[model samples]
Target: MDLIGAYSDDGAPSPSRSGDGTAALAVVSAAPEVRCGTCHARHFPLSSCISNGIYASSQVDASGYALVESKLVSQEDTKFFQGANTRMIRYNLPADQMHAPVQGPTHPSGRKADGGLSNHRTGHVEDSHLSSYAFDEQYNSFHSDGVAMDPSRPVAISLGPGVGAPPTQPQQKRQRTQQSKVAPAPVDLTQPFTLRTRQPWAEKAAFPEQELTEEHRAYLEKEEKAEKDAGSGKGETSIFHGKALEDYQGRSWLEAPRDLRDDSATSFLPKKHLHTWSGHTKGVNAIRFFPSTGHLLLSAGLDGKVKMWDVHNQRKCLRTYLGHTKGVRDAWFSNDGRKFVTTGYDKVIRLWDSETGAVLGKYGEGKMAYTVRFHPDDDKQNMLMAGMADKKILQMDTDTGDVVQSYDYHLGAVNTVTFIDEGRRFVSTSDDKTIRVWEFGIPVQIKYIADPAMHAISAVSVTPNKKWWCGQSMDNKIVTYSATDRVKPNTKKTFAGHNVAGYACEVSFSPDSRYVTSGDGEGKLFMWDWKTKKIARTIKAHEGVCIGSAWHPLETSRVATCGWDGLIKYWD
Candidate 1:
């Protein structure tokens, strides 16, 4: 079975034997002659010879058939076995010992007759050359990091009189010029790298002056005239569309609870869901309670609308104010609760009469306002400040609608502005990971707080006693800082549990300052004990990131939360 198509010189089927009298296997092919050791046969594909598990050399008869020996003597040849008792021969050949077949009249040395294994195209080879690399006993060198020793350069083995190692060619040295040592100029971080020259988000004319048609120009001019003269109420109106204005006129439906009037009462955690207000067409960004009274709730929405909800009565949106043309980022109520300010991505800060739903004044310097706050002092209610995307704290006079002063120090967009120390000074946070304190009406910064491990503070709230302030850090924690002159962070009071990363969720303090509550990116309301720094409760509050929560200023357990799902919830 080991032989295939073995034939004699007459072309009849017959097996053959080698000179050593061992049985041989033969194969027949029409290819040219091939020789290996003492065996010679016409060449066939190497795959056919090795298919039977034997790579034995073959001897060819005159009729072009190969007789392969059964017992191979060369250890480099392959052998076939049939049973457990059968003998096996194996070859272990190094890669370099293997040679490809030479085509034209190759000799036993595997060299062609004409080229003799030294052809220019095929490369020179000698019979004794089994490997490509040779070893040298006396000369060996290699390159390291520095200069390598050149073997071509001669060296003396012994130093005799007037004789030494040959000198190496001198290497050229690189010449370096000394840098100037003049003192560096001082840098003032209080100023921006360059003055702002243009505002891309600033409001512009409907069309360029040169391109405006007469009708379009006239209509725009008339609208502008009306808006300026207060004829259009600055594009704001009290018309409630389908609802009666009388319901909101005197806020008659709202009745402040008796217990809410006691300012000294301690706060309690809200345990039950009270109500949900679903009016915003997009995500709700921030929410606020009426100052002192907490009778009404205000919310700013990504839909570019501000809504006022009656807290004590209908628990519905009492009035909606439409002013900003883009998403509203923040909203704040004045000390008396009669006025409120709103800032938005439209690059405008708006002041509105809460009762009348009329926009009183609009102010902007072509920079997006991220947050706004009214002066806490009663007499300074007309003055307000805004944190701008341009990295500045802008103090504006609501009555005049003009920016009176700018506190410019932050290297990033300002996110929050809170007045502490009884309205004499204010603290601001920025994306630059800094908290800055400034004296009111002053253009200089009073204190600059920054740290290598600090995160950006998105929102901030001062405790009722004005003793501590907490910031909603983007790191998913509420970090506390002193409200005193030193303005140092209170590291021992970090409240962490819920995730708020990538969101500007606002944190709030309970009315009595015994607890802190914040909304998280997971739409859960998280409250932490002020003294223990442990979570009091976690309530599933919304369907999306709960961006802000507000504890009632007067009530012990009332809380309001708003989220990106476009709904606001009341919990008690």
Candidate 2:
């Protein structure tokens, strides 16, 4: 049976050859003279050919109705099966090829005859033959970073360059110049300059200026009235939402003391093990210190949970936050550290209270979110950015779950998104083997680091000064690129001698931008001096692959690492 069309147990009659040679020739040779009336006319409806096959040669069926006959494959016409392998699938499909009727003249709505209303417009200019693309290979596509302003703008790269490929340098540079981002400039013109959203998912306003929905407005009004009636109870209210945590603790919530480690002790990392926080039952996936309080380290694990710890006290788990239905992939703290965001294979983004471990809100990403980061600026922000498995970088206002912006430039899964250079800009790494540099609010890429070999960048980091960008390759190496403006990445520096193969190992930069550190598939930590581009230390930090590593913001030497072995190790 064929893959299309319904057939009965006793199939309908098909063309066949009779035993008698002279009669068989006459039986199968009743070929109809296929002449198309519409193609000969000025219009041809694609719908009629596709649905009813009216334009093809037809013969009467058992019901005495015309049925467009399916064409048989001609071995000389085309190579229908060139290199097929039966080893992959259990069984082979029927080999005889079948095809639809040959292409007919198309009349896609705009080309009706003069009597119809479609052709009644007398003054409007009709689409000329010169306006249509004549090439058979031409296709439709958006620019990797933005919507193409011209509908017929041709892409340099062909279709299905999956995972990654280096962008054509000349084309990218030309588009960069032509589609310049126009910031508001004072001018003598009559109209003030206005900015618009460049991508469809992007909202025009930032978190603070965004218009509120009816549901959010009602929730805010109720929350505010309740706060006024309470009149300053045991715990303080959220400054942004005026809502208090349901599980608020008395007095010591925000005043919780920092870890007892002395921040003034060391300026350089001492390659030695200090302490291990080891209560998690499954592999630890991510680790980071709180932005507001640098002493508290936060970790998410394969156990579908998140834990906060005092880095100085190895055994004490400060708090356990639970909401995700699957293993937690990544977590990030807000600038104030009062709220944090977490994402996982579950595809849900959860905002949690840093102090009380309460799940405040959530937004469902359609695909698994690999990593998440809080916006660096503190101008009343609740924007949470995440790297999605769907090869896109997305930003959402956690307050209303309104998408602030989305970047669909990556050809593969987005693995990392990190803010660099005092948080004015950020970089995203993808399995597509490209690292893109983007400004905070700009909709297009400012810079790109593309490797020709399509080496998946599992993770990436940027220096504090934003002078350099680094990416972690599955080839067990860390590659560096210049992030300074007025430069394009044609050459990349490679740091070798680490084993990150088979693991999406996370990477980080020292607070001073002098050292680059990353974990390997072998559960060891690799730290390299950026200036010398040499390995400084390689220590066994975990029994399994270490996927997360972080350097303290306030302290230059203190570092934390977490791995699949379910241990969080601290070092200084």
Candidate 3:
């Protein structure tokens, strides 16, 4: 019977036989090199001597064959024996010779033993692959010529010519040609040194100093120039430079129509367009009604101008306020209707004299103001709050033109700010997709709401009864939240069906709090039943993005809409 013993250097198990056909057992010994003291050798376990790369051999008795010393081969080299039908014959070496290459024995079938020629791509051991050529010129086959295998080299070997073939001629090393440096041209210290080069089509590539010709200067001097007070005549019909002080002081333009008396009555959705105001040269971004009376209308436009119209009289533009150097983003009137505030992309906020069209105060710190609001209570009218592009809500004293408080916690640009809970607290929304509630004079937030499903709220509107506030979300929906201290999101009352995404379309509530209305990016106006959250009406209001809407305080059926088409339309 054949008895399998242990693995050998060739990665196969060695076997031994006994004379009576009984299984043979292995004999273990320790090398003389491992000594305990003089004239004495320490005995070790079979595994200890093998682990230390030390071996010892003992003479075989008459009943058994001779035993050989063994060495360990890697697991990878052992796979070659399963199909090769090879027998293992172990040989020993000192522990210091482990990294050196050793020649493997040949098989009786005239085939060389596996010398680590592994098909790395397939990871299989090949049999009798005696041809030295491979598809690629590189070979990983290990040979014992006093050279060690380098594991750091790249493995791109394939079956191709010259894989392991010796070169017919020795290759010489290449030599690089040296370049000589030329001395640079000498530069004069008196003249300026310039690297500017001339172009093929021009005389010189550098620009020359500009000077006007004598004839050009003479022509400019002859042009007519207007005097500073040229058009100040009493009857000149100029809105900016003419006399119209008597009409403004009389307060005659502030009278409310008899029809817009009570705001407590139920409101109705506007059915038809009433009047179209087309004076703005660019897109109108915001519209507001004169405080409480709804007798006059105020509009801010991308044309960098604010204009008020006589809503109760001839419906003509009563005055034009021009101070912003860029698009005006938001405008609001003071409680008395005598002063107003305008904030714009120019990073300037100006308090204006509503009647005389004069700038009374300016507030800014070089950051664009996105929206502005006056403290709701009459006692705090001097306080103005503006949402800035730098993620800060700035509160300034309009009377002193000094910034008083700053709220700076939002992670993105602040978009809208609305006073809630009777002007004691305010709610703010930002591009960071968070709704924050803050106390009137506090710089820290009291409530914070952030959800993964929430989009940025571009504008916010409080209901007339002060119970709930709605935000115009960029996800094409208006989301509602309680206006009280809890400030909980009201999922059941969310009003949708209008596309307001990407545009800061303003949302508004009817004066009686019976309906909710908002403009959309498709130039359409939408109204929803406040309780049922159903769309009540959809009107085609403008030719471009309808961005802002306001329901008249007293007239239940009257609503004003402004859009990117640069027109403000009144619907009733």
Candidate 4:
């Protein structure tokens, strides 16, 4: 007798006693279970089966299969099959990989009146599947040879038709046990679910169809091992095993223009690191965009050179900038893509045409320019700002090779200077533990922001709307303050997790200002939600301290990171 229809030789309930009073062999059901046709993965999800009603059974009277009893299948079971809650979920349903519906016992409502397999477009068995449960004939009682519990066999179980002792109830197929008392509740797919139980199916045993022959099993295992060994290396391109089960060609996801396709337009959230650049021989300190409406990336290294790369194809360096006499500290692109600028410890600031990589002007006057930034205006090529090691903020008029504006208020080295409010005023942070906000071309500072928690602000960034500004403190914290209320310097929020630890860690906002991102001294990147002040992610990105990071100005998804390990990485 099968598991579901099991009966004693006398047509009584099973767990039959043998001569020595031990139970007889296990009752394995002859029922067929749903499974993936291609990969041979077992059991269709309740959602997949119920999308067409009850599960399509393979049993039928004309095929000599025993009729199923209607009393065994309660309405509760049918309801469970149609619910949204399920233990398994199919993430994607590619048309080419879709299995054809088995044309056997189907649900009444599931089948079309034409008597064909229901829902031919997708895949569903016919409604006659319910007809198998006629409840008219008493299923015949079949006997099996008793299972012999041999001490020589560890786990191997042998069963034959007719005669000896039964296996333990724990080992009985589909026999309900006290598993529910010790284990967590299974996801009852017919009910509304509240809690998430990840991978609940792993706790259950597989159906017989899930079992494979030795040869087929070995072949699949070998292919799986090979795919993992090859990984995404050696022209594999994708991390997925494209050689084996993934060979089925599906309909192209990219058919129409990007925006018109399935309404999933592009977004730039650094989901995964795509490529790494190790072109620099020394630590990389700066990274900037090539100012392209298309795609380009620029990075400056302590090796005393700057490299340009295609943003989409980052492995190959497109061009190299080589004028710095010493390690380059920073680089910036003009609002227009025509030119860009760089600064170095060699006491000079150099401007070059972006296209030919030719030096256009050398602007620092025997001062080690520590930081540089291009004017925000597209037409303001002559206007730019730089901080010198001499504790001076110098604004250069490249047109006349003169430092027309100078602000020498800070007692310590100026760490960073950035324009705000349409370049009408700018903010500067120094090693002296002060943040000075000043109007452009004015010699004296106008506003001073010094918070007790502002432990050595190493980097500062302004929100896109100029409503707020933030400082990355070396004391392993980032603090934000209101930009509009300069008198109060109203502390907005603070984010922590990454260890800056007295190093120059770069910080900035997402393009929409929803997030504040930073690089830490521990070679990691942290992103914080502005309102929640909670860290969204902490990414281990480099071997050494990560010094600089830049999110794409337009795309929310792409971010470039630089580290003291002399590597630049792009994540999207």
Q: Model 3 Cα displacement at 473 (Å)?
A: 0.7
> Where does the lowest 10-residue lDDT sum fall in candidate 1?
171-180
Give the per-residue lDDT of model 4 (tens digit) for 1-572: 24434345576543323321122223222334556333344543221232223323332334333323332343322322323446663343322223323345546566353343345666553332323333221111112443433322233234554443454556664344544445655555465543444344443432223668999989889766644432322211111111232123642211111222221223335779888887889999988764533256778889778887655432567667676646888888887666788887766688877656677787874687878887787677689899888899998988888889899999888988978777777889898888888988889889987757566677887887688778888778887766674524544588888888878888877777777889888888888888888988888989889998887755666788999999998888
Better of 2 and 3 by lDDT: 3
Model 1 RMSD vs true structure: 20.9
lDDT tens digits, residue span 498-550, model 2:
88887877778777777788888888888888767788888788887878788
Give TM per candidate.
0.59, 0.54, 0.62, 0.52
Query: Compared with the true structure, what per-residue lDDT tens digits does model 3 show for residues 228-247?
Result: 11122111121542235446
Candidate 4 contains a number of clashing pairs equal to 17
The 0-to-1 C-alpha lDDT of every candidate, in the order given, reads 0.73, 0.65, 0.73, 0.66
Candidate 2 collision pairs: 163-432
Ranking by TM-score: 3, 1, 2, 4
Off by over 4 Å in 2: 1-262, 313-315, 421-424, 446-448, 487-493
Candidate 1 residue-wise lDDT, 290-312, digit = tens: 77788888889998889888787
Which 10-residue window of candidate 2 scores lowest in summed lDDT?
93-102
RMSD values for the candidates in order, in angstroms, are 20.9, 25.5, 17.2, 30.6
